[model samples]
Target: MSCLKQTVNVNKAELMKNYIKKIFAMLGILLFKVQGQIEDRTLPTFATYPKRLKINLPRNIANPQHIYIGDNVKFGPGCFLLALTEYPTSKMRNSEFNKATQKFNPVIKIGDNVTATAYVQISALERITIEDDVMFASNVFVGDHQHGYQSAATPYKYQPIWKINPITIKKGCWIGQNVIVMPGVTIGECSIIGANSLVNKDIPPKCIAVGSPATVIKKWDDQSQIWIKS
Candidate 1:
């Protein structure tokens, strides 16, 4: 009788342990789903669409369709893409004062496999192009125009003179977090821009640039397959 009672107690404990383990496993799965695990949620279905170019997730808005997205472009949540045509009503007048191009609005051409994180803003009064396999980190701003300083005193309601230009980010470029690409700048192919850098000039291909006014700190070598200090 004593032996039977001990056996029964052990069996019950084992069953309870199994139940707790199952419950924990279920909670773990639920947490992953809520955290945007693509395999567990709606993301995979959305990603499956072959024509789904330039996907802007929640918190993102586009006023103008200046975006010409080719295949495999993924825009993370909170990314904003706008054209001069879609400039905020309050800001449009300011932009026109320094207008650089006769072009009514600029164009943004995003090529294949471009990935951008949250709070990325790409604006153009002239063309801004991102070529294949470009990756942009959080809070990156790419603009091809600036309000003309000469028109600072102009009424906010009046058109401000704009100095529009072009920005081209070529293939395989990885822009680090919080980097700002200013007007008329070209980030050459296979280059990297370090965090918090302000790019005001052309960056040569296969180099790494960092600084307030970006300066190349390293150049990539094809033979060595490494980035060496320049």
Candidate 2:
């Protein structure tokens, strides 16, 4: 018995599709490596970073010496951290008068294991502290002071800064996207602030707050191991 050999046909479209996928995959890896190199150059400016800190490029970091970062703190792209030394308030009205005092005294202390996704801006005129294990979503703005709207005629940028109060976020808190945390606000431990919320007031520990002006919607009941209406 004689056996006949059958000719096999290869699909060109399938081969092209796989080749394209591989090209894209390689490009993605190369892009990330370049990004990592760029990000590393910005690390030296920080007051203290014990190797575990990660940050994406295009970071608007000013006075980074005052911005103390802890281990395992990862910041995504567009992370703007400014420890503002000069914000003209009533106390700092006279340049000559305030010169004797701390000419540049601004602090932004971020604890270990804190993570911010993208576009998280933390600007401190006095102090803005984020405790350990805190998570921040994109576009989260935390400021210890606001620019004075003393005169509508004058642009807000030209006006002096008012309400120079320190802000703090306790450990294990999750700050949602587009959340604007204003001056003197302290979010208690393990609390969750909802997206697009304006945190103008202090939120108690273990509470879920939401809205334009964030209000407590639910409270964690340790006894029942459930979240109850606040």
Candidate 3:
């Protein structure tokens, strides 16, 4: 009788351990399903979901449908792409908002083979076009709108008017770290913008520009086949 009781106790212990294992397995599968659903929500917005288009998590993409990305575009963590469809009210227009709004459809079109590092922000109020093979270093900001600060007495944040313009970064451009590409600016093809530069005006093609209000320091002379000082 004693032997029989000991056998029954051992069997009960084994059964309990198996039951706990099964519960944990089910929980893991449930968590995986939930995560998959979250990732799938962003898929419908893409124009074409090409293979190997990697985007790290924790990205802030507002109006993803209005933002079209081409093939082989990789975005690092903390990248924010804002494409606003309507005019933003005062309550919605602020640094925290990263707003982009226009009378027409505001679009952000990024071409193929583009790589944007961490904390790269592209805010399109009217339109912002980035051509193929463009690389943006960390903390690069591209915006196509500026706040109207004509009123001295009014607080800058409360200024109702948003000056909307369009920005275009042409093909084969490399924007260095902490560069701010402002409104109405067109960065010409194959241009290299230096770090900590502010691009307020249009940059000519095949030039190396650097400074607060970036000026062309050197330009490629096609005839000479070399970079000449500007």
Candidate 4:
């Protein structure tokens, strides 16, 4: 009788342990699902511009709320403009272990009467200024910096390093589809960049540039009103 009672008690304990494990597994699954939903359905906050501005932006992800838009600025569908600031100045000076404060300054200053087509990505790491009467076609990426490629003895997280440069586009410029403007590049006034052009160098005013490493193909003589091919 004593042996039977001990056996029953051991079986009951094992069953209880298995039940607790099942409960923990179910709770973990529920927590994971809830966390995923929260991440997947996150929304962005944007500053309110004027109602006269015609825009068709559909991205509700994490974007800055302090965006300034002009009255006649038109944005097509699937346009992403993200402005984020990092590495506080106070933290860098106050903490001895902390790295230098490298703030990510993203400025999108669009002038009046500008048209931005679908799928344009403008990620300004420092400063991105677009002047008046400019047009951006679909799939244009204009970024200010490439993330640091340096190798360190410790993990990358412990050592905070970054590289950033400013990008500027002057007035009356037209950028065609699939154009990429790298860091520290300036597009001079009234210039045109053709489709699928990678702009790594500075382009002068009143000129047309195309190809992977873009070169000046034609320049408009404003006074003479003729195209000069170079």
Tell me, by lDDT, which candidate is best.
Answer: 2
Off by over 4 Å in 3: 1-44, 47-51, 89-104
CA lDDT, every prediction? Answer: 0.77, 0.87, 0.85, 0.74
lDDT for each residue of candidate 3 in 115-187, tens digit (9 for 90 to 100): 9888999988689999999999999999998767887875665454476899999999999999999999999
Q: Write model 1 residue lDDT over 1-230, tens digit each, in one string.
A: 99999999999999999999999999999975665554223332221233545444454434345557767777777877766663334435344455333335657788888998778989776789999999999999998887545555665334443667889999999999999999889899999999999999999999999999999999998999888999
Rank all candidate structures by their lDDT, best first, as comma-separated numbers. 2, 3, 1, 4
Q: Give stretches of model 1 more than 4 Å off.
A: 1-56, 86-103, 155-161
Per-prediction TM-score? 0.71, 0.85, 0.74, 0.66
lDDT of 1: 0.77
Is 3 or 4 the stronger prediction by TM-score? 3
Model 2: per-residue Cα lDDT over 1-230, one tens digit each: 12222221235666788999999999999999988987886565778855678888878887889988988899999999988786553444664334222234889999999999999999998999999999999999999888778788755555667788999999999999999999999999999999999999999999999998999999999999999998
TM-score of 1: 0.71
**Model 1 lDDT, residue 170, Cα:** 96
Worst 10 residues of 1 by lDDT: 39-48
Candidate 2 Cα misplacement greater than 4 A, ranges: 1-17, 87-104
Cα deviation in Å at residue 184, candidate 1? 0.5
